[model samples]
Target: MQTILSVSELSKTYDSRFQALKRINLDIRRGEIFALLGPNGAGKTTLISIICGIVKASEGSVRVDGHDIVADYRAARAMIGLVPQELTTDAFESVWATVSFSRGLFGKPANPAHIEKVLRDLSLWEKKDNKIITLSGGMKRRLLIAKALSHEPEILFLDEPTAGVDVNLRRDMWQLVRSLQASGVTIILTTHYIDEAEEMADRIGVISKGELILVDDKAELMRKLGKKQMTLQLQTPLPLLPPALAAYQLELASDGNELIYTFDAQGERTGIVALLEDLNDAGIVFKDLHTTQSSLEDIFVSLMKEAK
Candidate 1:
């Protein structure tokens, strides 16, 4: 994939003598969905703001589609659209009027045909003439997306796009994001929902304390760090693990009714055969057993803990 955006040695310092971002370097691939995950105040929003020209970086530089963000602000910003987390649209203005005005803000000529398509694509056509105040929360969220698409930008930044949305609306937004990607838009989103990243992102980037800790292909990251567990429901309870099973490092669960063993999913040998044979030698019976694989959320939590 081609690099759509690049950040080199980026840093941000506020008036209060606080560093919001450290020498961050990142590259966003064109036409791909990249998910940025971090805790609150992790500098995700600050990075996006800098790339979109909303905030200036204290040091280093950014290039959007090969245009310097600071030197060629207009050209760089014109290729980007931002959907902020806050709902700050004019309540008195109709959806259509607001969306149209947003397009004009980008110095783009009025194009009713494009606006109509954007509204319809967002499923906001029926509410086009309705006042923003009269729209539901989900409808308003969709309207934000419509306004962002109004300028037909090649790169879209969604800052917690589904923060307070309901489950159904979240699903709808996910579909809309995929549709946008299909239309050749590079999407960069910062979200607290791990599942959103797991389901939508081709690549995942994790930031902590203003530092870009890691960035990698989502599946590769999971395979490298993810773990798997197998739980055996013993037919008979054992107060203590046998000496023969000590090498397995099993944990007693359900008050000794179950034995849990955790191991690396990518390990060459799972040792399941040895474990079972040892169990049988020790006369430990199991009525049932189940296995589970770690998810993105598990890895995220572990990363955050490690960062701390």
Candidate 2:
């Protein structure tokens, strides 16, 4: 894949001597949905701001489509659209007017048809004439997206796009994002919702304490970090784990009525068959058994903890 954006040795610091980001390096591929996951104050927004020319980096460089963000800011910024985390828009401005104004700001020639199409895609056409203050929280979010896309940017940045959104609205946004990707727009989103990344992103990047921790294809990330567990509900309540089963490293739970076995999901063999045979040799009988795969949230939590 082609690189759409690149950040090298990026760092940000305030006059108060507090560092917001530190030596971060990242490359975003064109036409990919790359999700950035991090906890609050983890520098997700600061990174986005630097890339979008909103905030100046204290050190290093950012290039959008090979144009330096600071030196060639106009052209670079013209190629990117940012839907900010906050919903700060002209209260009395009509949706259509505000969206049109945003396009004009980018020095794009007036194109009403394009504006209409963007609004319709965001489900904001019906509210195009409504004042920004009159729209619901969800509608306002959609409007923000419409405005960001007004200039037909090659790359789009969504900062917590689904925060505080209802289920239906969230699904609608997901579908809209897919449509944007289908239109060949590269998307980089910062999200706290693990499921959102799992469901939408092709690549996942974990950032913590201003450092980039890991970046991998979504499926590979899940497989590398994901685990599986088997729970056996035993028919007999053994006083403790059998010495013979010690090699399996299984845990005795539910007062010895259950045995828990954890294994790597990516392992060649889960060792279930051998464990079951050993259980039989020990005269351990299971009344029930079930297995479960770990979710993205579990993997993300484990990674963050390790980073800390």
Candidate 3:
């Protein structure tokens, strides 16, 4: 895949000597949905701001589609569209007028056809003539997206785009993102929603304490770090785990009615057979059993723990 955006050793520091972002390097593949995951106060927003030219970096360089962000500021910025985290809009302006004005900001000639398409795609066409103040929270969110797409940017940066949105709106926005990806738009989203990243991203990056700690293909990351657990419903309750089964490190739950064992999913030997055999030797019987794999949220939590 071709690289659409590149960052090299990017860092940010405030005048008060606070370091917001450490040395970081990243490359975004063209037409891929990349999710940046982190907790609050993480460098996710700062990194996005630097790339979008909203904030200047203390060091390092960023390139948008081979154009240096600093030296080729206009061209680099023109290739990107940002749906900010805040809902800053002209209160008195009509939806249609606001969206059109955004396009004009990029020096794009008036193209009502494109504007109409963007509005329709966002489900905001019917409210195009309505004032921004009269729209609901969800409608305003959609309007922000419409404004971003008005210039027909190649890459779109969504900063918590679905925050505070209703579930239905989130689903609709997911569908719209899929359609945009299908149209060859590279997407980079900053989200605290782990499921959002799990569902939409081809790749995932984790940032913590001003550093990019990990980045990997989503499936691959889960496979490498994910855990699997098995629960056995014991027919007979045991007062304590026998010495013979002590090596399994099993947990007693449901008042000793359930035996829980966790192990690596990718391990060559999960030791399930050994555990069951040991259970039989210990005179324990199991009526039923089930297994489950760790979710992306689990991985994120574990990573955060390790980083701390």
Cα TM-score of candidate 2:
0.97
TM-score of 3: 0.94
Question: Between the candidate structures 2 and 3, which one is better when assessed by TM-score?
Answer: 2
Expressed as tens digits, the lDDT of each residue in 138-163 for candidate 3 is 99999999999999999999999999
If candidate 3 were superposed on the true structure by all CA atoms, what would the RMSD be?
Answer: 1.7
- All-Cα superposition RMSD per candidate: 1.6, 1.2, 1.7
Q: What's the distance in Å from true for residue 154, model 3?
A: 1.1
List per-prediction Cα lDDT, in the order shown: 0.94, 0.93, 0.94
TM-score of each: 0.94, 0.97, 0.94
- Cα lDDT tens digits, model 2, 121-240, are 888899889999999999999988998999999999999999999999999999999989999999999999999999999999999998999999999988888888999999989898
Q: What is the lDDT of residue 256 in candidate 3?
A: 89
lDDT of 1 at 225: 80
Write the residue-wise lDDT of candidate 1 on 51-144 in tens digits. 8888889999999999999889899999999999888678999999999999999979999999999999998999999999999888888899
